[model samples]
Target: MLLQKFKIKSMSLLTFNLLLAIWLAAVLNVPFYERMQSLTPHTGIKSSLFIAASVGVLVAAYTFLFQILNWKWTAKPIAIALVFIGGFASYAVSSLGVLITPDQIQNLMQTDISEAKDTWSWHLVVWTLGMTVLPIIAILMVKFKPEPILRQIVKKGIASVVSIAIVCSLLFVFYVDFAAIFRGNRDLKGMISPQNMIASFISYYKKKAPKENLPLVTYGTDAHRVINTSKPTQPKLMVLVVGETARAESFSLNGYTKNTNPELSKQNVISFAQVSSCGTATAVSVPCMFSGMPRKDYDERLASHREGLLDIAQRAGYKVTWIDNNSGCKGTCDRVHKFEIPAPLKQKWCDAEGECKDEVLVDSLKSYLASIPAEDKTPQLIVLHQMGSHGPAYYKRSTEQFQPFKPMCSTNAIQGCSRDELLNSYDNSIVYTDHVLNQVIQTIKDVPNYQTGFWYLSDHGESTGESGMYLHGAPYAIAPIQQTHVPMIMWFSPAWQQHNATEVSCLQQQKQALRSQDNLFPTLLSMLEIKTQVIDDKNDMLKQCATNPDGKA
Candidate 1:
């Protein structure tokens, strides 16, 4: 009876399941493999030999892991989980042709279900089943090899060590060639799927664990909005819009061929033509923009702990309010008075099965501003975070009225569509954005009481199938212009600028000057006329051109 029971606990099946995961991880990562081969230093035998050794080392190491799993109590469950990780990582790798860095993992953690929904497709569903779920079912059905638990543990542990040693020895022999290839393509290290995901998790945990304890550092406690008693102007009410996935190249104001900015172009808005984003992802850009630190000097953990521009503005006596329609301000407005539209749901801004229309933002703000006590005339800083042109479902961002472009790419997968169709879909989204901005500007005007102004900037730009790249979040250093160059526009009512002594024409002349998210913190403080030791003059783009020629107080 014991011998018969051994058939159910088949050791071969356990090893097979684990090996299957390794195989799927490697085979599905075609881009990484091809990129590695292309970067190999030499040709012919030397290259072939190096590739073989590299593959051998990887397979041998994973094989050793199988030996270790073969001895564990929950071996099957662990194996199945690893398989799923490998399969999902494959989907991610295939879609982006990019490595799964720890930062990407962090970004993934911040992504809402609505964002994740845009990534799904029939191809992904079919591939995931074939690669992961079906295999798991097969593994569960497969019989296992059973030996005495104590003996099996000892035997497998010994064999695992031996296998690991053999792999290390092989690696040592081919160390020079292997190192050269990997060093040339450092990102390829993370392309090794299930291992990459495991590494990302370990990295995220290490970074978050100790850093979470850091206390929030305050800045500009003496912050008070500067009111020029000599000029004697009304208090300012400014709207800071943080846009999503809007590339500079798509905006007509920035000289794009399309009329993507027909509505915005008609307004008295200063559209900065040469502005760049700090990061290629919202997780990086939003927080970085709010930080006093520039992108090159910024640290996510340190920035998150330190006081930021919004907090400083808050301390300065602005009745600051953050109304979010995008992914939750990336923790930028956490300390301020904030409201978030419950996503993937029907808010007033939401339509067509849960996509929030930008109009929802303008309407919501109108209602919210109306509720503010009439007695309080304190300067107000309102932030509207828009879900602008967030990809592959670009068709979903705009309403039917905004779909001027015909038969745009309605599918979530941009790669599946023709280039013209993809551009059409994206342009239509921008047209919708123009409409939203027009509404937002009009809403501020309707309020009719204070010096009203609006500043619009995107968190990051996006790749619209540019050079075969889609979506965003490539490393900033290596990212394409399409993913880094973002649209930035500012609108101030003529009366508002007149009261505050801002020269709109002067500001417009600086449109061609190079600027970035680094300008946001200092420039915004300048806009509110808040001056402090914390404000860096070098980072303020508007300072050079914002002044009237007469230098009037």
Candidate 2:
């Protein structure tokens, strides 16, 4: 009887392993596999294999623990829970194409999960079915066997913990070496164990410094200052509109079918048709665009070392202001004047059933802009960061009035949404954005005495159901055009033209120049006429024009 029981347990273990192998194979079908291959080619094959093996081992260990503890009836439920957890975790990691940092993961869970509560009911249903109902059915089939004694279970639990630790150690080692190979960094010599190697790899990243650290030039400096020594001038006002989740592919300015940018198209706006983004996500792009570092070298360690464009504008004697509608992450605009919409007031914007709209943030913006102190300005730089077209809940992005297309709202979740539906909802958001942008441009146009120029660029673009992908955050190397091909437009008022002819001509030249966010730092300094000793002549767009004389082809 003992021999027969041992054979039964062995067969059960084999079945568990087989099921886990099938699940592991299916996990690779998630859309991010191709992107992962492109981003870290050196570790791509090994990492994929490691991930598969880890999942298999984790499932097997869970099965073994349940059996060894004689908690056979409970095994099915625990196994089901593990499956859902593993699948969701894999999906999230695959979508990002990298292992998410602890802070980022925490922030994402807090904000995105809360925001997605209403629309993600289907996900909850799936979890319930897998974790509860399926397990009960499996338990009934096994005749609901009684659990083993607590002492025996404790012994099995300790063994399972040890096994998990070993598996995790192996995974950590592989991941660290993979990252080192992908980044082309030399491997550590002294690190013998996986845990130590991971520690060393993290230390290396934390200690890495920015490739360049050029100081900013402001308006009062002697080398390149723009302050009027000859005569007094009126306080200038410039509004830099930092758009959100806006893709260039959908904008009319970038040859899209829809007239999404009708107002800006009608104005004297210069749209750079081929503008690319530094990163696909706001966390990286927002800081990178503002900082001096190019996307290739952008790292969190350099965030504090470098001053942003806002800092440059502020040092140039401009009052910097930031009005934000997005979730406050990393406090990117801490030094600037910040006005966040009240949470209680925002709650009212939700429907009787509790659904909210993006326009609610816009409504708050209108009131906030009107309340700004009219008197104070030594030339003010107001940054309006819109909640724009942030999604998954694309249907809630805008109202029906803005919806030009029918059957627009995404019927499925972001992952399953049809391309046509995604575009329709996305375009509607752009339409609403255009209206808000028009209001901002008109307000800037009406501002007296100040030479106003409005520049608009999205943090990054979005994937609207492209190649079975529905959102942004693809790895940089293989990030689709939808994520990087972003819309950029500059509108210069007649007053700006009258006061700064040299700057206007420089901007016009830059319009044709092969520009990136790297040029943004020096370009803003040149436009504002801020002089500083720290500006690199080689990187400065204006200096490039001065040297080339012939424009960039």
If scored against the real structure, what TM-score would every candidate get?
0.87, 0.70
lDDT of 1 by residue, 265-355 (tens): 8888888888999988888899999988898898888887788999999888888899877778776787999865444324555655565
lDDT of each candidate versus the true structure: 0.78, 0.60
- How well does candidate 2 match the true structure in TM-score terms? 0.70
Best by TM-score: 1
Which lDDT value does model 1 have at 22?
Answer: 56
Candidate 1's C-alpha lDDT?
0.78
Clashing pairs in 2: 224-531, 225-531
Q: How far in Å is the alpha carbon of 270 misplaced in model 1?
A: 1.7
Kindly list the per-residue Cα lDDT of model 2 for residues 1-553, writing each as its tens digit. 4333433222243245335334433442333334334445456567677555544444445444444533454555555554544554444444322333322232244354435563364754674476445543443344332335674456556656765775566657666644654465221111111112234345445553223453532322333346786876666676777788898788887789878887777887777676778777776778777776666677655564556667767766777778666655344576677766667657866566444555554555556556656765567777778777887666766777778866676643555545576678889889878877877777778665577888888888887756545566665665678888888878888877877766666656655456666666666666777776655566566676565764352
RMSD vs true structure, all candidates? 4.3, 8.7
